[model samples]
Target: MPSPARAAAFAAAARTILAVTLAVLLAMAGGALAADAPAGKAGPEKAANASAAGSGDDEDEDDDEDEDEDEDDEDDYEGMPPGDGRDEVFAYCSACHSMKLVTQQGLTRADWAEVLVYMVEEHEMAEIEPEDEKLVLDYLARFYGRDRRARKMGR
Candidate 1:
């Protein structure tokens, strides 16, 4: 058998190897999560202003022009059905991207829930209140659901 001191040294070395292995695994998991994280914070206005402020006045003017175009695009949702959560979806969802994107999707209620979770986790959307979440899900599942699209398209 090995000497007592040699056995103790071997045990210590095994522990050291195990610790280093765990540290590397944890670091790799952290890197993966960071990679999946959104590009930046939630607010488009803040991001826009920060970039504009970093550049000169000419770029600021260009940003204003871009805002004007965004306003024009916002009109695309004018025909959205008026109801309990219409305003909530319009305000929250459109803050990041166009409402056209919202209109284009025909997801189930479960899928919409998953989308909300994705928005919060991956895209940094604010956590919505439970009541408002229900309203939004109801509206989306009623009006923008796969069944409705299927009926409309005769699929």
Candidate 2:
């Protein structure tokens, strides 16, 4: 029969081998995910290339079209309307989800405030600064408020 010390050493070695194998498997899985990711997904090299490509193209109309395409590629908050607090709302909300999730809502200002609180408490979203929170609430209430029919009719 094997001695206790020998068995312990064998067990330890087996565990070490298992851990190394698991680590290698995890690394391969991560590599596969990265390979499958879309080409335009965020990367430092892609950002530098986008900006550099757009900078020198101001002299030609065709270049302007190319620049617009580049801008569209980088546009994360495409559906949100232009407004005073649009940037603040987009920067905060789009970190976790698509801007369409926000644009489809038609809540009053108080309900919008409640949603923000719910996001922070339930979904672990970061709390907005007080000033920025006010701006975001104002923007949401104005553009996505409950009187959607009225606003559309006016337009």
Q: Write the per-residue lDDT of candidate 1 for residues 37-81, one digit (tens) a residue.
A: 332233334434544675665543667777674564334344455
- What are the clashing pairs of model 2? none
Question: Per-residue alpha-carbon lDDT of model 2 for 1-155, expressed as tens digits?
Answer: 99999999999999999999999999999999897543334533454465578676356468777667656543634555556676677767766887778888889999999999999999999889998899899999998888973576675
TM-score of 2: 0.51
* Candidate with the greatest TM-score versus the true structure: 2
lDDT value, candidate 2, whole model: 0.76
As a TM-score, model 1 comes out at 0.50
Please, what is the TM-score per model?
0.50, 0.51
lDDT of each: 0.73, 0.76
Task: Please state the error at residue 82 of candidate 2 in Å.
Answer: 1.2
